[model samples]
Target: MSPRKPDADVPPGLLLVDKAPGMTSHDVVARARRVLSVRKVGHAGTLDPMATGLLILGVGAATRLLGLVGGHDKTYEATIRLGQTTVTDDREGETLTTTSAAGIDDDAVRAALAAQTGPLQQVPSSVSAVKVAGRRSYDRVRAGETVELAPRSVTVHRLEVRGITRPTPDLVDVDVTVDCTAGTYIRAIARDAGAALGVGGHLTALRRTASGPFDVTRAAPVEEAAAALAAGGGPGVLPLTEAAATVFPVRAVSTEEATALAYGQRITATGIAGPHAAVDPAGRLVALVEDAGATARVAVGFPPAS
Candidate 1:
């Protein structure tokens, strides 16, 4: 595919991608950049190559909104294998240790998972993308450096066990669905669960089910998205006006107000605790506004009429 020259006319919006397994999150962004012909494509969250499911990308000016998008809670379905631990806390990593899981029972598994639910501290995997001293932990690991990440608070709102299977006499696979706040790691959950049960554990599979307002059911396949855009059916980007309206509190403004706000003017606040979408009477988003006492000021403005 030919790279699209940077154009000011491309519409800004989000793309919900059903990422295929074995492709890194950056791979999808690179493909979207080529397919949509837009240079600015950013994703809200990262999914490891071994995982599949919903991945949200922002195109063009929507890249400015990715930080907000990334703040939303996420849901995942994963299989945790008890009996072995890995360097990465997932199947893709090298196995570091193994222990018999034959003596573990369902009741104990449920109890351990239940204990992990709600607010608690979690240590990310050693090979996670988290930065330490301005460098990625994974990069540090690959360079043969020892890395220890500090624990941070995370909330796992709900954890439901879907099923359990004994693939072998000494190995048990627990399938679970998790709803968690942003930054929660499913791999870490598997690792911790196994440690709690005195058996080493690692993630075998992971599939994200949802991220805030976006769900896997509504996501288009990455290949389909690329094909549709390349065929000129559309950029396949979700409309920005609808996206902003749905994701944030809305404040209707007149064309005059819209124009003023787009030019960095502040309008009267309506007591809405903002980051509210200030929309024109026609329902197009003019700016993201926040209330400050008597007025609302633009947090981000889409100029030239998006």
Candidate 2:
């Protein structure tokens, strides 16, 4: 047998994927592992099988950074159906109840949605991936475990109703754009809005629009990644330094400072409060630096000569 090439020692970087609906998050990672040809692949957040849109995967050393990004804010475009309740809080679940939403005029819909725009305590869907005493809530529920998730503080930075349609007295479909914190369930938003209006609710469709600065437009499908890798071009993975420069505050370091970092030493200071990306003379992202008390050194290590 041919010797297998070693998995990359250094984390490669982030691959922004435009995940298609119908596959679990783990499935995306498995495909990425083949295309990127590295075992250190990981993703920042989970998207439901029925939801499509941007998914950010970390390659190599970038896996270490997933935890940081996972907890950041996210955005979505979702369709909420009022006048119906579902077992999973979404269209895929069995219908549990239905109430005619004919009395819910647009003015009342707007008011209820507006009330939830800022910070709110939200109860997650019972079938969520959240853990209950070490078991996945979804798993427990499927096994006949009654699930009840408590309310948590979550911020909805923005929620805009794009359009509303009521094709039947028993169904009210509202398309909305939502920018919210991580762990905020859009399904719950639909469910609660209906409950608030004495109707019923569940999410019918969902598409993640953005996560942090990453968005759907920049996401590459697994097929695209595979084609890129097949020609030896590699999966257009974003180099950490370049990715950092694109995403973080750019601090131009002097020749001396860059050299100090390249050599594992510290320069006086960039005079810039960081969590900042530092670039070399060639415009190569070298490190992410912060002022840790007295010295300015690398907080994230990007191999200097690679």
**Which candidate wins on TM-score?**
1
Worst 10 residues of 1 by lDDT: 228-237
lDDT of 2: 0.81
Error of 2 at 170 (Å): 1.4
Query: TM-scores for all candidates?
Result: 0.94, 0.89
Write candidate 1's Cα lDDT for 11-108 as tens digits: 67778889999999999999887766677788999999999999988877778788888889999999999999999999999999999999999899
Residues 191-292, candidate 2: write the lDDT tens digits: 899889888899999999788877778777865753454343444456666667656788888777777787778766666785778787788776778876
The candidate 2 region of ten consecutive residues with least summed lDDT is 226-235
